[model samples]
Target: MGSLRLTFACGDYDRTRALHEGTVRPDGIELISLRLPVEETFFRMMRHHEFEVAELSLSSYVKSLDQDPSPFVALPVYPSRQFRHGGIFVNAAAGIEEPADLRGRVVGTPEWQLTAGVWIRGILADRHGVPVDSVEYRTGGQETPGRIEKAAVDLGEQIRIAPIPEDATLSEMLADGRIDALQSPRVPSTFRPGGGVRRLFADPVAAEKEYFTATGIFPIMHVVVVRRDVYERYPWVAQTLTKALHLAKREAMANLYDSSALRFSLPWLIPGLEEARALMGEDFWSYGLEANRNALATFLRYHHEQGLSRRQYAPEELFAPEATEAFVI
Candidate 1:
């Protein structure tokens, strides 16, 4: 049979650039990669099932598993991961000097189901003694208006979450102290140049490194998923795609070590790369289930604790069996 033609949609990241540029082709597959902004790709895939393969929010993927017929099945490929300590911004005058001060305060988030929000809330609760239900949560667009939760979540009575005014946004609310803090992946418009917003952690880089030391978790934000129908039709596609993505990521990582020239624009790129390797070890940005099991388990626990997932899930449950294991030579 001829190679299967499949559409894969995801953000344009260096790790996945090889796949997008046709430098790495999966076995028995003709990949058509559509590079789009994460928000657009996520909306189209989640709401309309637009692509055969796509990058999806980790929290949203976990939530979707509870559906009668889950919409998608994921590979063990993590396209995006980050330390979320930098994403939490608080009103400078809200008396919120530290994470604990967030208790009894109104915090705004773009959505309850956002992957970044999930990680930040979990970290606050686990490391900083701020429980998930301790603060009131306001959800709305960060800069624009009329944003709503994409995935339907039932928080029951334990969690307090509501929407900001239809005319208002989280950025403005945070800037003016209507909300005591904001947690989001995107920086608020008012955060720059004395716009009345500052990161909760003044030195977020230090905070993030400290957090990693304590928890050993570099939070995962997004995963590659295959539409359920597509997976069912070609069971082997999962493994093929997983292998191709792993190869692509390896090439990207290897490129950073070339001392003759800079692979990225940063002035101290070599030092930064060396520092990351020293701290996290090689294969820091890893693919597959085994390498990331602990982190994935932590995220699933957080998803359940924050009322996003119905119950805690094993990291193994998130990906297809084909994608979870590899053939031994």
Candidate 2:
């Protein structure tokens, strides 16, 4: 048989490289990496029919599947450490003490439709008694109406108006005091100014825990998916790839600093890498079948409720049969 051709799409090039070098079976798998912007990668996958297996954020993947669900099937790969979303960084001098203080505040965000942003708005509106329509929302571009719509539906009229900008940096805006608070998934170190940016309350993991408690679904961050036809033709590919990824995760975790330093040639990640190594020691990166199914089901249910998708396909329809059967709940 000819070598199996596989392609991976990743958000971080360095992580992708580490996974590629550390995990993939070189002999049987002809793994190729593509460098494409996240938004453009989705369209390119549709246009070129390029990859067999692709890595993608579950939100974006669901959006793509909503456009056409037949070509792709999402597979669970790894679960990232839970991180807070919509980190509201306020100028220390703003005296914004509580969530209610965000009223009439100018907030900066990267993506308007991002799940993090939507969820943050929902929590703030529901818990803080803050009027949803009273705050001003700014996006980098005018092409963020969809995100706005999602937020509006989730938050009601509590969201007042939308601001579009040709070129605006949230960090710079925060530093210059152009915006009162900036919301993002994670706080970048660069965002901290002398007395400008200070973090407000973030949705604790308990909130996410409650979400899981209610729905049996954890919000999916990223997933591995393959074309439906490709899986049909290459039955063994699923097991092969999963095993390879498991091995890769193990090796990478064991030698996190050495591997990361070797790949990046920088010491920036050394400390964090050591911490991650210690934290994730002996913890396998691979998710069992039941865990992945639940995550996907939760994601699909969310998108459906939000009107982002219409059809409700089963979890089995999104992965190889063996993979579906591999890790029974």
Worst 10 residues of 2 by lDDT: 142-151
Q: Where does model 2 exceed 4 Å of error?
A: 11-19, 26-28, 34-50, 79-81, 93-95, 122-136, 141-163, 186-190, 202-219, 232-236, 256-286, 292-307, 310-321
**Candidate 2 CA-lDDT value:** 0.57
Q: Give per-model CA RMSD.
A: 1.2, 6.1
lDDT of 1 by residue, 220-295 (tens): 9999999999999999999999999988998888887887999888889989989988998887898888888889
Highest-lDDT candidate: 1
Q: List per-prediction Cα lDDT, in the order shown.
A: 0.91, 0.57
Clashing pairs in 2: 132-158, 132-159, 133-157, 133-158, 133-159, 133-160
